[model samples]
Target: MLLMLLGTLGVVMSAAGWLSYRAGLQEAGEMFDARLVQSTRVLVSLVDEPLSELNAYPGEPIVLRGWHGEAQGVGEALAFDDGHAYENKLAFQVWDTKQRLLLRSDSAPTTPLAVAEPGFSDVVIEGARWRTFTLRSSNGRWFQSAELADIRQELATDIAGGTLLPLLLALPLMALVIWWSVALATRSLRGLSMEIGQRHPERLVPLDPADVPREAQGLVSAINGLLQRLDVALARERNFVADAAHELRTPISALKVHADNARHAIDEQDRVQSQELLGISIERVERLASQLLSLSRAESLGGARAHSRLDLDALVRTEMEELRPLAERKNQEIQLTLEGAQLWGDEFALGLLVRNLIENALRYTPAGGVIEVRTSSTGTHAVLTVEDSGPGIPEDERERVFDRFYRRLGGGSDGSGLGLAIAAEAVTAHGGRIHLGGAARLGGLVARVELPLDT
Candidate 1:
């Protein structure tokens, strides 16, 4: 659009310049014609007195012939009885009523002047331009005056040259005005971009109409409408999680009590069988309770707040202490390694993340296997890793394990399959990431978490 506007302006300016040039030339021609006609009239008056005296005396043919002789010399001699003849460069000619040339100026062409209606005329002789004016007197005498047409052409050229400087000076000033208007027009858009770019991701604020242009009002309204919808959807998801957890807790608690009652049978054989059933039921209830809590936390904790500074190494050590007895019951050694790392995260949420990873490692590892928990720092981030000496998860199932209720194929774990999902939600809430990879010392699954060093 700017190019098109400049192009249109260029064309209009060019046309105006051309018209001005032609008009100047035409004006020069008109002034030259007027001057030529005035000079012709003056020259006619000069010769009229002499010719009238010769005509006043009839039969004095000798006087007329002598006057004619003087006129022939006058064209070349630049002499006048009144001492008023041109001194420099003017052309003159005298002719009879029969169109016979009586005398000619020294600079006049050898050919006859092309006279038309006894008025101004433009004629060419010997490839040179001339402006000629003819006058017929009351006597049988004619006068003609001519000047070079180069004078008019020179005047036109001078006028065009004089106009150039102003035209050149105007260009930059015109460009500045155009640029200023364009910048003013786009100021609203720049403000809009800055306002949107500086906002927090969780901030669903609507754009202000007063700061937006009329043309962009519809787009701002649409974006505000979308943010409202997302807020409603997120609210609904949180409510569903809270409702599901409340509903599932009672049934799980009742099942655990009934399983305990069954295990207290009087018969020894029945008691042994019922104890196995009670153990299975207890594991199932634990899995259900853990999954429900994870789902509720994942749904409720959107990216509403930033993390707080805490010692990540101390957090990992505390969680390992609680899991040590479970690892020992399976004849597995749980090792906790601390590197004195500090991280910014929610303490309670991060504790849940460490517990889930350790439990996941314990579930996959066989008896007598080793599980390692490590915490360290890397430049601007803190890292936590949990690995076990068991069959490692395949690459294809790594991402799926982070989804709700997504258990790996051929995996044997008494879990509700929400451990990794819950851990992922907590890490994401703290602006951190969690991934499953090959362990360095253990041939099993390695779960690593990295969180920012600053809140």
Candidate 2:
């Protein structure tokens, strides 16, 4: 903005200076012309020859027959006492209508004056410019007057120089004024920076718009909007931590009581039953703790984690290997059918996603049922499939499966039901989508995850 102002000021100042200089030159020219005309009139009245005699001879020297018809010698010049001494200094010559040289001023050039039509004329004599004027007298004599052209040129130069000097001098002052205005305009921005710098790290309060510049109001409003969102997010995290701790305490306490009872039992049969009950209670507590941690991690992962290229086929195989023992304990087998496919995702989050899906399938499948994992790439998407030979979820309950702690009706499993929810959250964090349906090959649940091939 300052540069633009300076450019505009320069154009205006240059134009104004040029116009003022032109006007000054023109006025000086007009004043010089008026003085030249006045001098010509005074010189014309001094010729004293008759109209007929003046026109008779065309190229002869008519010796000055003075005002009393006396023979005046060449040095005995007629002195017209016009108070202006500069006019006396002017070179002039007089001629008759017949073109005879009647009289000449002592200052006139030695060469005879060139005859021209009566008016203003320019002539070069001795390599210098001269302004000349010719006037015909009532007695048929011709009066010619000339002034040096250098005088008018000098006057014009002086007038233009005088007018332009002040403007040139004021240019620095104008620049200073522009600088001060710009400094005042940007003062609000400096104040805002100082205010922000002094703020505490925990203080997320909105800035005052009243003190901000109108042009920067939108920026301040956007900052305030971001602060409001952060405040809400912090508040939500606090509530989630409090609720999760409160919910887990009860199961943990139950597990502790059952373990203490199992340790005190005496008889073999009673001890076996007590041990089994304690084992189940402990498993329940473990499931609760795992679910709470997964849910908390999922909520926090929202686009904050860095992602990298991962081999989906290798990841699925690893997850299947880890779950193979659990499947064997139930008289079930885990199978993997994967293609060499790569995906971009957070490694830890994708591992959590695959682990939860496989665990969900294992917990719901019957003793003799099998769980299969598969990974393949299609066009720009990487796909992962986990299928189990178990009762499939109904179409209506499929959407609800991703809700935290939402267990299915008639589902027989000592699980926290948060596995699918964790899988959904992790998939979303990687810019992926998850779908649940009946598996065509296994006639059971199928969980498919599709993610963009590029990050």
Best candidate, TM-score: 2
Q: Write the per-residue lDDT of candidate 2 for residues 267-288, one digit (tens) a residue.
A: 7777788788888887788778
lDDT of 1 by residue, 199-303 (tens): 887777677878777888898898888878777766767665665576467556766675766767778877777777677777677667766666667656766
Instruction: Please give the CA lDDT of all the candidate structures.
Output: 0.74, 0.77
**What TM-score, computed on C-alpha atoms, does each candidate reach?**
0.47, 0.55
Pairs that collide, model 1: none
Instruction: Give residue 230's lDDT in candidate 2 (0 to 100).
Output: 79
TM-score of 1: 0.47
Which ten contiguous residues of candidate 1 have the minimum total lDDT? Answer: 60-69
Q: Cα RMSDs of all predictions?
A: 18.2, 11.1
